[model samples]
Target: MTDAITPHPFAFPDAALEDLRDRLSRTRWPDRETVDDWSQGAPLARMQGLIDYWRDAYDWHAAEARLNALDPSTTRIDGLDIHFLHLRSPEPDAVPLVLTHGWPGSVFEFMQAAPLLADPRAHGGDPRDAFHVVIPSLPGFGLTEKPTETGWTPERTAHAWVELMRRLGYDRFVAQGGDWGYAITNELGGIGAPAVQAVHFNMFPVFETMEAVDAQEERALKRLRDFKENESGYQIEQTQSPQTIGYGLNDSPVGLAAWFYEKYEQWTDHGGDPESLLSRDEMLDNITLYWLTATATSSARIYWQSMANWQEREIEVPVGFTLFPRDIHETSERWVKERYPTLVHYNEAPKGGHFAAWEQPESFTEEVRASFRHTRQPL
Candidate 1:
């Protein structure tokens, strides 16, 4: 495969949009949940409303235009066409930074934050905080070429990211991520890539058993336990049998919408309603990308390939972390320090959850600027 970073702008076929609308119109919905709240999964009414809006009001063309505005491109890395958005900062002294999106997420997650980070001065922040931002869709996700073969785990993805960065002329750079983005970033720092001078995570996955020495740690452990017991059914199914579920997710737009809408409801930091924080269009922007790409099964396979093999390992590079309160799992600063000895930065965001960047772009942007302030240098 050629190492060609081709300009791959968004231009979805009209027939694809027609098919999506037709599929939405003909969705075979299931019966309503017995419970009123989200305990049983996305409520039938909630999903119906969403699907109604998706079919009637949502504009895929508008979303397509937004994606194209990010300067989208693709390159063959490891025999796959990896789609990514690359934005060079106007500031000459800007530091190169790569942001990796997680499952149920696309480059759409960073649409707001990427611009803020790349042009801090334009956003009323210091020019010194500017970053040459690169947001890559994970292999088998979004517009990226789906892997036909197995073995594309997070570790392998991390290596591909390093190569992608190197090919982009970033001999030295910083990394930031959350969710599976956190997993991939963790691996990036652990693998001793000299080019990765520092790494940052909004979600630090700490699985090691340690006694809680205080109330905060105790609460964090309780949340972790709760996530494992109640909130991880999707993880179990995806890790064990992604292909089985892929059939439904790929075929039905409603199925795909409900699958991701559940997480937007359960994971975001909002009152009872996720719509209070995230607009319907914003949520659909990401969900529609998944539907258009037909990556439901392929994206799920990442969990199958990576989760069982996860191990606790020290990340030697300097690290930064911003823990959002409403996330699925919480880790005490002590736990973070244990894993990242050279901890350069850590903070608790006032708001946001699993989709931190999307939920609170301003806060997410500020955190990234602060986290890498110490690592910035002329590239």
Candidate 2:
């Protein structure tokens, strides 16, 4: 862990806002392309429409206010400033649940789920499902500043989360994650940290240790392999040359928008039209976070920091996995149990993708709640 203390509130600086407007006004937009589809890139017309809305219509302050309304806080743990949203349930004795966001995502990903998790009744769920929720921005993403030193791997991230729970006076909590969040939460349990009572994941990576290559995993693995072979160029690029790409992304707003928007369409379960599944405003809000924070480069640091280190370790916690149809590939229960000796639950979703929080919060919440039912302490 970096010897840095926790972070403070991330106020939207006026200077940053002024700079955004200036950039928008002076944007040297690309020439009108003749094509209609996104083959070449963001369709020229759609890009223009979004840019106009972003520059003229969207309210950054309103978004900031919504963020502020969530009861966020910052505290230093193990030398890093950690910014997190802390929503305590009205249920008085709610279970603590730590939710983490993955790369290309920020705490904002939980905008809808935070309140819902904190007060399930408000969302038409049982009060038993209400939870004391903690959603933190990974160090160096969004409001959390990037680590200036080393040892910021996923394992270290788990440590930070443990310390965070400790500071809040919680002895045990349920843990949930997707994408990189899944990796860190797994580490929390794998390390046998008493702070984490159980773990739940929407996105999980399966290795060979799980049951003998079952038919489903064999097929999922084949598809995974194919997906990587054909479309994993971004990982290679991010790991090796993030700064190079960051330069181009940082120089042009549209470049940054296109870079992320492409992934939203390709990696998500949006059928054909992305808007069918996700709101355009939502997509832009996320992209705007990256664009304004200039987090494109720092966010990639996670890839370079942990991608290699994690393949060397295994998570030993009692794990539960819920596979979504739109995910890159599905993991067979046999495979997961093989890799994770303590595996306890396996689930499947009708529809959703890597962005499960945004796409299916109800199912995601219930799955998390169900996975953690075994972890409750005896009164």
Candidate 3:
């Protein structure tokens, strides 16, 4: 692959946008679930409301403008074109930091948090907490070129991140993530890359074999069981045959929206409605990204490539973690320290969930700044 990095300003053709609206208008929705609640999936009324707004009122160009403002760029890495948003801080001492987004999310996840982290002074915080943020769209996700061959696991993605940072002139940097981002960031710390000074996670992967030591651990275990039994249908399908499901998601705009919107509804720290925390436009901005790029299948392939052999490795690099209360899983400090021996920071956020950065940008920004504070001394 070439080492050249070039600007990747993007705008969907008017025809594509019109096609998306036509698809939404022609969607043949399934019958409503018998249950009033979301036990089955996204409620029919909710899906209808989301699609109606998306088709009639949502502004794709506005979202596109916001994304363009983040300095999007692309470079060929590991036989694929990787897309990333590099936001440099005004502070000369700002630390270089890479932030990875997980499945069902894109670089849009960090839109609000990136600016706050990059220029803390402008966000009513100390200038010393500034970061030159880098947000990369994972292989086969977002604008990144979809891989034709297999083996693009989180471990491989972690190494590609080091190369991406190197090309950006950052020999050493910190990293942070949630969901698959956690897996990738964890690999970054474990790969023995001296350039990866530290890592942080909003989601902690707890092994199924670990025994609960206390009330908190017990509750966490229960939640894990619930997730595996009930909330993992999508995981199982995506891991087993992503292509089979991809045909539907890629064909129907409403299908793609419902698939992602269910996660936002179930994962965010909202009451009964996801819009309580995330605006309709905000959620659509991410879901729309998947639709426009036609990455639903390519993104799911990450699960097919990695989930079967997933295992945690001990990370010696200094580590930090912020477990949001409403997240799918929460691990105790004891469990985290066992894997991250040099654990430097740990906090239990009062609110937020799996999509912490997207749902609670201010809190996510503060947590990131605090997590890497100790690692900022001359890299």
- The best candidate in terms of TM-score: 3
| lDDT values for all models | 0.88, 0.77, 0.91
Question: Which is the better candidate, 1 or 3, if ranked by lDDT?
Answer: 3
lDDT of 3 by residue, 314-350 (tens): 7888899999988988789998887778999999999
Cα misplacement distance, residue 237 of candidate 2 (Å):
1.2
TM-score of each: 0.97, 0.90, 0.98
Give the root-mean-square deviation of each candidate in angstroms: 1.2, 2.9, 1.0
Top-lDDT candidate index: 3
Q: Give residue 287's error in model 3 in angstroms.
A: 0.8
Ranking by TM-score: 3, 1, 2
**lDDT by residue (tens digit), candidate 2, 1-379:** 4333343555778888778777877878788777777656667777777777777887777677777776667777777678888888898768888899997777877887788888988888888767898888898888776788767988888888988887887778888888889888878877664667778888767554444356776777776776677656777888777778778787777777777777777678898987787777788778777877788888887887777667524656577888887776578776666667777788888888888888777777777777766655521
How well does candidate 3 score on lDDT at residue 169? Answer: 90
Q: Candidate 2: where is the Cα deviation over 4 Å?
A: 1-10, 30-41, 207-215, 312-316
Lowest summed lDDT across 10 adjacent residues in model 2 is found at 1-10
Question: Which parts of model 3 are misplaced by more than 4 Å?
Answer: none
